[model samples]
Target: VFTLRLIHIFAIHKQLGPKIIIVERMMKDVFFFLFFLSVWLVAYGVTTQALLHPHDGRLEWIFRRVLYRPYLQIFGQIPLDEIDEARVNCSLHPLLLDSSASCPNLYANW
Candidate 1:
């Protein structure tokens, strides 16, 4: 396997052994942080879904709103108008007026 070959190469190079060990440790730390981030995401996502789309029945849409949206928003793809009730003009904006996309609720903005 590729991993076996990589281990063989790391084993053959004495100098690389320490570096590989450090990399493995760093990978473990990265996994830990990823796990932590996932927990927080799920917690926040579920709570936000309950507050913003309590009656959402579509599994796919619910998943998108909960996980995908939050992940993208974290990296600055935030929907400012969608999250703020006052800013959203659902009637004028065709996109916001779409059945799939509703205006933000007062509770969600708060």
Candidate 2:
């Protein structure tokens, strides 16, 4: 009967339709994830720029760490002469940078 054939085709088409939709949705989800990742990468770059050069210490990306005495002493091992030279060199040098805020004159003068 025509009704039987119509019913059979409808069932087959119904199954096929969902598979097609699922495939399309999966592709869309993949595209969206990649798009989100790219946007996050851009956001990360912008956020890093903000964190790297905090003006008033309000940036959230700055990490706080308590430096123990020996840790500080062994880690940065700059001689007093070197520190003085750095201070003098940094004062006269003219490249304005964020990292140099800690040292009165700490830019690599090269």
Reference-based lDDT, each prediction: 0.73, 0.45
Give each model a TM-score.
0.76, 0.29
Q: Which stretches of candidate 1 lie over 4 Å from their true place?
A: 84-99
Query: lDDT tens digits, residues 1-110, model 2?
Result: 99666655665685665676576679999999889765665555455434433342424323321122223334564335434643443222235533443232234311
Instruction: Show the colliding residue pairs in model 2.
Output: none
> In model 1, how many backbone clashes occur?
0
List model 1 lDDT by residue over 1-110, tens digit each.
99978876896687998888888899999999999999988888888877876655557767887898778867878766675566665443555444645444566654
Candidate 1 lowest-lDDT run of ten: 89-98
CA RMSD per model (angstroms): 3.9, 15.7
Clashes of each: 0, 0
User: Which prediction has the highest lDDT against the true structure?
Assistant: 1
State model 1's lDDT: 0.73
